[model samples]
Target: MFRDEGYDNDTLEDEEEAIMSSAIPSKVDPLDFVYTNIPDTTHILKLDANCKHCKAKKIVSETDGFCCRNGQIELKQPEPIPELMRLWSSMDADSRHFRENIRFFNG
Candidate 1:
């Protein structure tokens, strides 16, 4: 009876591990705060914002405009809304619910 109980516990643990391993991992988009695209013609701005890449001050000056304080940071374009929504929908219900509750400044 003890051996049977041990075997059952082992089976349950294996099943739990398999379920966790097969579950889809949650994804995080770094550019969730960006609401609008920065126009190609508007490279330099007087506004104060953090660089999406390095989390440093975004702009310097009009004459010596730089993306970051060190002028080495580069921004990445966000995934298209439809593609992001598709991925979001594919996630497990619990993950989707958790992500849906997250609030971003832009929206």
Candidate 2:
């Protein structure tokens, strides 16, 4: 059992490493390479409010989701509507009800 668990752990770690490596470009200076190869464009280190991805600019939120420079697709987070509905259904009437239901509230 212990040996089997160790083997499974090793497999998981290997898979994680493979995924992470694939996510990032293999170049020593990925940014430098991009700047040299690709056309002049804005450089973003992280996706935040100012970032186009977070602001849902350039790409439609309901459609394209996020944009990537190298044509690499950005995966969308799972929609919360269904999960919220499930939670609402499971909850009692009092617990589910909200006093002040604020809609379209953005930080």
Candidate 3:
């Protein structure tokens, strides 16, 4: 069975207060942040040539040379992941310890 109608009113008020408190922080300044220029979807689309798909710029017909050639495109100069791994492995013990300390403090 439910409680009296008046008891539900008090319970609802308490729940609303708890939700509002959690939503806003104790210390916050509205003026601390400034709004920059609004986003322009049209300009962004123009900047990044839509060669990504078969619709932006077509070299041949409306179905061919849209994205690079066709099929899968190959990288001109592939990144050397192995060299990066070797460099990371060569880090001194003190540097590694400092990185771990920083991570712990941040977390």
Q: Which scores greater on TM-score, model 1 or model 3?
A: 3
What TM-score fits each model? 0.22, 0.23, 0.25
Comparing 2 and 3 on TM-score, the stronger one: 3
Candidate-wise lDDT, in order: 0.60, 0.54, 0.59
**Model 2 over residues 52-102: C-alpha lDDT tens digits?**
444444522333433454245566797778746664466565435531232
lDDT of 2 at 14: 90
Better of 1 and 2 by lDDT: 1
RMSD values, in order shown: 20.9, 20.3, 16.0
Give per-residue CA lDDT, model 1, range 1-107, as digits (tens).
23564478778789888898778555745575684575667545665666554656544452233545455656677877874566466687755764776565126
Predicted structure 2: lDDT: 0.54
Worst 10 residues of 2 by lDDT: 98-107
Best by lDDT: 1
Ranking by lDDT: 1, 3, 2
